[model samples]
Target: MSISGINNYNYQNYYAGARHNMAKTGGEIRGVLSSTSSASSNITLHMSDVGNSGNALTAMGFPDGTSASVFQADDYNPADPEYRVRYWDKEGNYTDTMVKVNDIDPQNASYLEMLAYTSYSDVEGLTKNAFGDFMNAARGVNGNISYDADNIKEKKDYMSMVKELMQLQYDSNNLPGYLSYKELYDYMNDKING
Candidate 1:
């Protein structure tokens, strides 16, 4: 059945519109309790309970009795895979509406952990050429360079490169206008040492 302006059940198409609406309005299509406080002024919504309670259907305007028929089987088991409802507010502030599903239930945790692990794995694969170049430039002869005692060789190599860059900077009139490398290095070292 279709709501007046909304289309009939078409999972793939429905989510796009739902996401768009939630993003534009800073409104939620679903939410779960995160925690509860004994203080009368604050009440937390346990998202899992909300999910298990099948409140999303009611918010979507499904009749109370039909919630199970609409969302779950006769046994009242969840049909959807684990997921948390989240969106950014109108002012671009991020709001996490629910704890990730995996964090809620140990049984449900694998998928989210796997997703996180995969994302970090991808980040690890990213080449650091830009960062390496920036580090190299920073160490130039005009740059104060120092290293911890643990990796003397690596530090020496880095400082050697920095010295070359500093020489180049000295030869050219374009050294950065900030404090000299020695002064900046001394201040930073003092702060760290203290």
Candidate 2:
């Protein structure tokens, strides 16, 4: 199971559920916690090889007293209908709460303010043209036959876009005190290719 909130992808709870199932079946299960998530999201892996107990917690690769993840209250946003987490007070009156993401999100332990994102469809306005170019490329690049485009502008434009993206990565510097694109790219390649 996967849950996506804005940019956060919560996958740690998946192992908790998988642990219960493994306990029931008396066998281990392998699972990828998530396909995508924020760079620092905590990933969990659980196994019940020796059966459930305090040892099971350690066997599952979690530290002692590690609590299972819970359903989090959504972030607060006055305008977004889904953002505000409404709760009933002790007196039974409904009220909106202004909770920081860290209050609910395990990943945002520093209590950073809630973030908002604009989710675009697969073919956004900018990608619409690129989509057309891709279809053209696919149809033209069929097996065994070699055919050239009557108009190379689309191909050239795609190459320019790739170049622009590379330039932007280098020009943007990076997060303060964090790896620059060049360092991160080279480091990643070294680790992967080594």
Which consecutive 10 residues in model 1 have the weakest lDDT in total?
Answer: 60-69
Superposing every Cα of model 2 onto the true structure, what RMSD results? Answer: 22.3
Candidate 1 matches the true fold with a TM-score of 0.18
lDDT of 1 by residue, 1-194 (tens): 23221212467666776676567546654431221113223222222223443432111111111110112212332332232332222233322232221233211222222222122222234222222222433344434543221221131232234344445444444344112322223322342355
Q: Which ranges in model 1 have alpha carbons more than 4 Å from their true place? A: 1-134, 138-156, 177-194
Model number with the top lDDT: 1
**lDDT of every predicted structure (CA atoms):** 0.29, 0.26
TM values, all candidates: 0.18, 0.16
Alpha-carbon error at 132 in model 1, in Å? 9.3
